[model samples]
Target: MQVVKQLNPLIFLAPLAMLSLPLGAPNSITQSLALLLLAPIAFIATKSAIKKPIFITILIGTLLVSLFQVALNPNKEYSVYQAIRSALPFYLLCAIVVSYKKILARIIAFEDRTPGSVQKLFDRAVRVFATLSFIQTTTFFLGFSLANALSQSENDRVMIFQTTSIVLVFFYSIIRRNFINIFLTSIVIIGTGSKAIFVATLLLTFFAAYSRPKFSMLLKIVGGTLILGGTLFYFNPLVIERLAEFAINSDGEKFKDATREYEIEQAKETLLENPATTVLGAGFAMQVSHGVPSLDPAWEENSKYDIENGYWGALVKLGFFFTMLFALSIAKGLPRDEFLMAILLVQSVMFMKTSYQLFAYMDGVCMLLWSICMVAINKINANRNSHQSQFQQSIQR
Candidate 1:
């Protein structure tokens, strides 16, 4: 452990390199190894490590919630072991990789000695985040395009478009304060043809425009709305036809509406029927006869969807206690920045439509999002206090 700790910081980015490598690696194993490898770097970077109360509370609450579910699960097979199967992997990975103790203090201390030095630290942070976001978005697009050129698997194409769209939206939101980055991301997101990403991006644009009380902001909002709205209106068949059809006829739409409504209704019914299980959940995989269900089982995998999406899924699987803990953790720790808020909203919505509970799936993105918000908030508060103190001293003098 000590030897690993003593190694170079460059080693920390080794996993990131695999991300850019030709798609030869087993993506899951590579991501897991990368995070495990980077944990030490995170530990070293974490200085003055204090187990914050909120973090501790969240941890405890989640555990209690899981236990509660175990107790309430009416299914004879439901047990604590199954709960572990569902929630432990992602939560553990997040806990290990994500912390601010080492990185923020070092960067802020080094960046500025003056009253407003925190601003420099923030700018530096933004640059680092923006660069990584660009790289990830670009790599996903490259992979998608390559796959599309070689074969026409609808699954591959959809995955490519979805990945590109979500990352582009998040990246754009992160740098909403930067016009050039935002503009570039906007173009890429449009190219991706994902309704979720498009809607999320537009929400972000509207938020950025309204965050400041200036005519320029209003004009950008109006101009951006025109271009984005018009482009989708014109060229994107998916947007103009499918999305519009779904939007107007959500209750009667064929694919999306049917799927969404079926899942939602089933989940609600399940909760209602098993009131006792509502707190902790029916104990993961209650829908299945055993741990593994056959691919072409009579009861489709869609039964899982009936329980809820990500957040609700967490509640059902981990119990209400843990879900609330996770929610409180976010509320307490994340900053009030417009960009941060937008990303959080987007993530929350995404999780509703799809499962993002896999360890490798959520760890990197969630960690980065949490770190950015916490660090930015710390800088903002520190600067605000310093300014107030200086003003008071001047008055005294």
Candidate 2:
């Protein structure tokens, strides 16, 4: 398909989609708005993709999986109509993002466009969100926020994945490495107190360090971080408390205080109960009846403990075949650029923590990652290839 003469409307939605407000702002509103807004973009992108067999073909494989999901029934407890009605939105979200990726890939990879403000703008939007959330968390830790604020702030920490993911990408994508964003997201991660993010951070730092003038600098960086971390630990009692929870207790159990102990067990039972459901999940996006009692009864329909864990969420929802298909699509389609590669690496680590990519919740953040990935892949690879061609011509000359 020919590149559109006009800019993709995603530029306007990109920031809106990524904007998850900080300081206990109503995220349900934002999440709804994000999905609501993307509905048309999904339609538009799909319509555009239809004209081009190549772009549509890329998503046809996965869209079919989402389609077949509408029919597959491993657990008779849920209705067939339930899959079509309930999974409609979920399917739409996945389609929109996948379609956008292919379109953006065409623009970036083959169309010879350079990484432009469209991307930096999305990064900047998330960067601001991450920084505000970081400040929000810091203030909460310092005892400035209301008693009710921490849950959302902690949820904001979940979003640090997006912030941190963006931070890692800019190291190789944007002009003049985004050190400020990197610094902000890193501190937010400390508040995360998540071993997954911590592990990913260490590996990211290792790779970043490896690229430094001397490999020996890794020692100095780690040592300095440890010392600073110790200093921060003393002052940040809340951080100390968060980290302490991860430590083994007198009972010799680790993560005793961890939430989702129930969700973990539920997901395991659901997946292991039947080989049919195990290989093919109970069904796509089946709303759990007892999702969250504290919220509206209607909201409970969205509840499924299975979703809390990314691996199980994807596995229990799409089962093995489609889950791997979705993963391989992301893996195969992404360009060989460090910026995108770093995000994928961190996301790989995040599979243990959340279902951002797998289940398609918090998908605006997922869109940001995918959008950035396509932009980077398209622009970086295209530019690199062009330069290589020019270099070959020069050699021949």
Candidate 3:
């Protein structure tokens, strides 16, 4: 028991460390292996806590849907397999959240001992990665062969870095609002060349700032935005150009719209062909190849055309009812805060252009945030109880 207590913090760090690693190389493998190792520990730690009925229902429902889909659409064997693989981590993370309150408390205790330690670590990591990315970008411009091996492309690196940073900012913002973290994270988001993420981050920033509605806080936000904007413009003028490009009707915008329309049309045709499949989803991996082709050949196999839109992806795999259940389950599980709600709303919009499965690495980061919130809430309640007890005792005396 003592040994387990000593190692508890390390378990939480495993996911963060895995997320920090380069994308598509060893990151996925390491995360899976770590989860496989940690699952038993998490279960042992929190098994005594009363299980939430809704989580159980959702878990069972998702599994049943996967199985039903597999049975009905045996041709989509690989799709079902991939979907299950993609979803397993999310379900596992939920189980960890439900059972690992003790571990969560331990992490919170560690944070209390060293205030801002997590945020500092996150900032340092982002800086290190960003520096490497900048060097690589510079070298590529200079026509250096070493640039290829130095770092991932700016677009890929920013996406990975920002995903990790957003998780940190989300949790840190909840604990203590800091403009520096938000500013740095915004820089990372802008580096992605993703207008949607930039807009989403902007909306989330305003939502978080307006939550307090203090004059000083509003001033800081405005001042920080100006500094951040100017710094980006001075250092990387292209970022400003990219942001400006979103407003204009360009060939890129036309191509993007055409692709989205084509994909939606194909989804409509596929659903119409087999109306019954619309209920539970043509059983995970029932491919509809009538639309846009995937650049990744793995997605092309088994008749699946990589659905970029998350909502459409969910609709394709889980169908209407299960999708609602899944969405509700996620909503129920998250910490109740307007900031978080705004973040989720923004993510939902961003998902229209990208695919983010529930079992993805970003979900792991979210699970950590949820655990931290739970610990904070518990502490607050405990303090309230203690204060009330003391008051009552004094009155009686």
Question: Of 1 and 2, which scores higher on TM-score?
Answer: 2
Compose the digit string of candidate 1's lDDT tens values, residues 213-270.
5787678667867876787566444545655776767467454555555555555555
lDDT to native, each model:
0.47, 0.52, 0.53
User: Which consecutive 10 residues in model 2 have the weakest lDDT in total?
Assistant: 146-155
lDDT of 2 at 275: 83
Estimate, for each residue in 211-242, the C-alpha lDDT of model 2 and write its tens digit. Answer: 55464565655664575367546644455555
User: Which 10-residue window in model 1 sums to the lowest lDDT?
Assistant: 147-156
Q: Where in model 1 is the C-alpha error above 4 Å?
A: 1-85, 88-107, 110-180, 231-235, 250-256, 269-276, 283-308, 357-360, 367-397
Top-lDDT candidate index:
3
Off by over 4 Å in 3: 2-10, 21-50, 74-81, 93-157, 161-183, 237-247, 251-256, 271-275, 288-291, 294-296, 299-305, 357-397
Q: lDDT (0-100) at residue 76 of candidate 3? A: 49
Global fold similarity of model 3 (TM-score): 0.70
Per-candidate TM-score against the hidden true structure: 0.65, 0.68, 0.70
Question: What TM-score quantifies how close candidate 1 is to the native fold?
Answer: 0.65
Instruction: Show pairs that collide, candidate 3.
Output: 46-99, 69-283
